[model samples]
Target chain A: MLRTQQLEYTYPGNKTITFPDIQCEKGSQWLLLGQSGTGKTTLLHLLGGIRKPQKGKVYVADQELNTLSSTALDQFRGKNIGIVFQQSYFVQALTVGENLQLAQTLAGHSADSDRIKDLLSRLNIGNKIHDRTNRLSQGEQQRVAIARALVNSPGLILADEPTSALDDENCKEVIDLLETQAKEEGATLVIVTHDSRLKAFFDHKIILQ
Target chain B: MNPLTLSWKNQKDRPLQMLLTLLLFGLGVGLIALLISLNTQLDEKFKNNLAGIDLVIGAKGSPLQMILSSMYHIDAPTGNISINEVKPFLNPKHPLIKLAVPLSLGDSYKTFRIIGTTHEYVDSIFRGTVASGKRWEDLYEVTIGANVANKTNLKIGDQFHSSHGFTDDGINTHDHGDGFKVVGILNKTNTVLDQLILTNTQSVWAVHDHEAEEKQAPAEAVAADDHDHDQDHASEAAGQEDHAGHDHSGHDHADHEGHDHDTHDHADHQAAGPVMKPLIEYPDKDITTLLILYRNRTSYQTLSMPRNINENTDLQAASPAIEMNRLFSMMGVGTDALRNLALIIVIVSGLSIFISLFSSLKDRKYELALMRVMGASRSYLFFLIILEGLLFAILGYLLGLLLSHGGMALLSGYLEEAYQYEFSGWRFFKEELWLLGGSLGIGFVAALIPAFQAYRTDISETLTTY
Candidate 1:
């Protein structure tokens, strides 16, 4: 579960972005929508504990993120939060499976190959597990990124414009994979994107202005 | 995966850079390792072979040459000292002298020198035992040293004609209807004796001057004569044994002084060539050198005797210890320069690694940030860069070590074949450990700035901006 209240952040140039209160229950799919310059990425970072808000009560898995030390926040984030970016950027030198395993390792969890294989099989990229991430097709790489996010069974999954680079068919397939995978892993999914096509996929929406 | 696997994958992502780093670092490490091994071994060999005799009295020439030629048997003899000229020190009645072993050098069986001396030289000075058969019982009966027998494949009873010069490939030959007979062989002694053919002084003279007709005494009679002569000298030498005993113990104490002063014991292996044949009295006889053992290492006679011989006699007295040090210092300058140059190469290689890592950081920032978002701490990212650096250094060191040994083995082969000199490539040096640590230190230092940069990478800025 993830929730944020009256989060306010200021950039170095004195620009401020005020966010609305947010809530996402377990296993629910939600979208954070905004036009360009609305600070959707800033809000995503704030919720993920990667950035500290100027003033806010940010909670993830029933714990106040800002109250934890940097090291503890890193540990807490690793164990409970998974993030997918706009573009698939796996460590290019590693295999698809290795990239997923890296997520588990960095999260301070033992590698679970069966979980990884099962996740990949659900995404139809299980056969490409040993293939280098850089050698995979764009669609397959996106699928691997999704697998990496869900490998640790995190409570919160934040996807920042994950399907923005894909064509219509690939965008639909990737979005479906992310939603279905997050549902299967029982994680609350929050996607921040400018893509209007994603509006129909999720019922819960928070539009940032 | 683990950090190591990640480091390896990172290296693989940039193969050219990785190879360049390895070669640069490897060459630097290889050259230094090779130098240390060579310097250690050469220094040991030079030090290990400089003991026993106090003076090397040979014909007037370079004292280093005299020592090298007669004592080490590595250079051409410095002309020849006549028996009459060297007779004062050789006399059993001489008060300051304890033992004088005469060496006659001119001929060779292959590369080994054919040395003619008295039986006392072999039995007393060298303390040698015949591995097979008996000591020479007749003229031209030669006792082969262990190395000579092994290299030339000569056996007892195998007769071999001597060449005219010291070289094995010399064109001039000695065929006087008499070839030297290998009547016996000496065991390996790890001294100059291992590379010589031993016979009586008369055998060398007879080989050079075939026209001299010599009256031959019965074998038993000559043996009896040498036995009488050795006994007379033994009794006379016994009266001076107290000083000699002190000299022996004093030399042992001097060993702990330093490696430069450690005296290698050279037990003289004498030939005696069937002392049955009477030797023509010394007057015009030209022997290569005379090795003298003093009654005491520090006796007033030992110090004054060399100066006395050099000033009063035609023969020059050379001290092995002094000449060898001069040789080492002279050789040291060139090798030290080479060693310093290798050190510079290692440093330059470290810089190259630094530049490569620094340049790669720009391209790797996005991936690093992704790792951070995946929950890797800043410290983990910092260590990843450092690990990559250490991996480069370790791989380079391993390759460099192999290159150095391979190069040394090649050089050792050439030296063995050309100069009969042994340079072992198998010896491990303590400096190698230092070299390893040095390489790792360089790697760590070179990666410092890049690793710090990785630690400071703002994950949110990198991820959002990209």
Candidate 2:
């Protein structure tokens, strides 16, 4: 479960953006729609506890993220929230399996090789586990990035413009995969994007202008 | 997943930079280590051969050369002086003198010097004991040092002829009478004594006596006092007593009267072996040098003995300690320059490490931020960078130690051949442990700025920007 109320942020030079209250049930998928400069990425960062809100309350699984210390907040985010960035960035020095193992260890969980193998097999890239992330194609890298996000079995999955760079068919396929994986893990899913082609995939939406 | 593992992975990402940094660091450490080992071993050898003797008296020449030739056996003798000139110190009843050992050097066997000295020189001065056979007691008998015995393979009873000069040029070989027999082999004393062939002064004198008589026997009837022959062999015979008297012309008649009385008493014991005859009996003879030890080491008279002998007497006296200090100061200039050069190389290598890490941080920004997003703390990133630096330092240090010891082993061969002093490379010095600490400090300092940059990385900014 995830909830936020009256989230406010101020960038340098006195510009401020206030966000509407949001609530999502467990295992539900929602799309957050926003134009450029609408502070959608800022809201996602606050929800993930990657940045502190100037004025806001964010609750995930009964714990208020803003009230936690920086260290505790980092730990809570690693355990409960997973963010898939717009660009598929990875630790270039590590192979796909080692990257997944690093994510599990950083989340304060012991490495589970079997779980990693299962996740990679489900993503149809199990054979690429030992391959360096840079050696993968664009679509494969994106899929591995998604796998890294899900490796810790976080309660909330956040996809930031996950389909914006993909073709129409690939976009549909990526969205279906995100929805089905979140459902299978029983995690609440939030996708932030401005792509109009993704409108029919979700029943619930929050539109920012 | 650990900081060390991550650090190692990052280092492997840039192999060329790591190799360059390590090479620079290793070369700096290796040069310094080599200097330290050489300095320590050289000091040990020099100090060990000082052997408690207070002063060296030889012919008036370079005092350092006298000490080097007589004490260290590394240089040729500073020309020979008459045994009569040194007779006062050789007296056992002299108040200030504890022991005065005579040395007659002017010959060698296969480049190893044949030192004509008494049993006291080997036993009292060097504390040498025979490992096999017995000490030399008669003319033409030799007790070889351990290294001489091993190198020349001259076992007990084996005979070898002497060459006239210090080196084995094969031209001035002494084929007179019978070849000198190896009577004893000395134990390894780890001193200059380990490289000499010891015999009584009579054997050295008798060898030249035969050479002189052989060359002058044909010309003796024609010209009895022909001074045209070489001065070294001219002083070898009793028939050259006129040349020895000419050397004593500057002294007073009373001293001459006392010397003649002592020589008659020594002649009464001439039926005994030449080793037991008083040195005064060989008044017409010459010796290479005299090693003197004082009865009262701290006495003012003992302290002034060298200056007194240097100014008044025709002989030159040198303190081994004073001469060795002068030698060390002269050697210090070269070692200090080498040490400074090594330090500069070390500093440059530190800078090299800093540049490589700082530049590589640009390429690794995303990976570092990704670690932060995956729950690595600022301190984690900081220590990861530091661990990489430490790894480089440790690897470079080990490589440096290997290189220095290997170089020392190679250099020891050439030095041993040239100086006949044993040099070993396998010994370790305490200074090398301090070197390790210094290397670690360099690693820590070089990593400081890069690690701080990693610690200050903005995870959100870095993750979203790319």
* TM-score against native, each model: 0.87, 0.86
Best by DockQ: 1
lDDT of each: 0.79, 0.83
Instruction: Kindly list the per-residue Cα lDDT of model 1 for residues A65-158, writing each as its tens digit.
Output: 9999876888788889988878888787788888888889988999899999998999999899999887887887888888888888899999
- Candidate 2: tens digits of C-alpha lDDT, residues B45-127: 88888899999998876777778878888766666778878889989998899999999887889988898888999889989
User: Across residues B1-466, which tens digit of lDDT does each residue of candidate 1 receive?
Assistant: 7899989988988999999989999999999999898888766665655546777887787788778767777766656666677767777778887888888776777868788887766776667788987777667889988878888899998998887556655554566665899999997666667778988776776664441111112332244543443343234223433212111122222222222221111101133332443333545556778888888778776788889878987778988888888988898899899989988988999999999999988888888988887888889999999998999899999999999988888899676544445777776789999999999999999999999999999988888775
Model 1, residue A40: displacement in angstroms?
Answer: 1.2
User: Could you tell me how far off, in angstroms, the CA of residue B365 lies in candidate 1 after the best superposition?
Assistant: 1.6
Instruction: Find the 10 residues in a row with the least total lDDT in model 1 chain B.
Output: B260-269
In terms of lDDT, the poorest run of 10 residues in model 2 chain A is: A69-78
Q: Ten-residue segment with the worst summed lDDT in candidate 1 chain A?
A: A85-94
Clashing pairs in 2: none
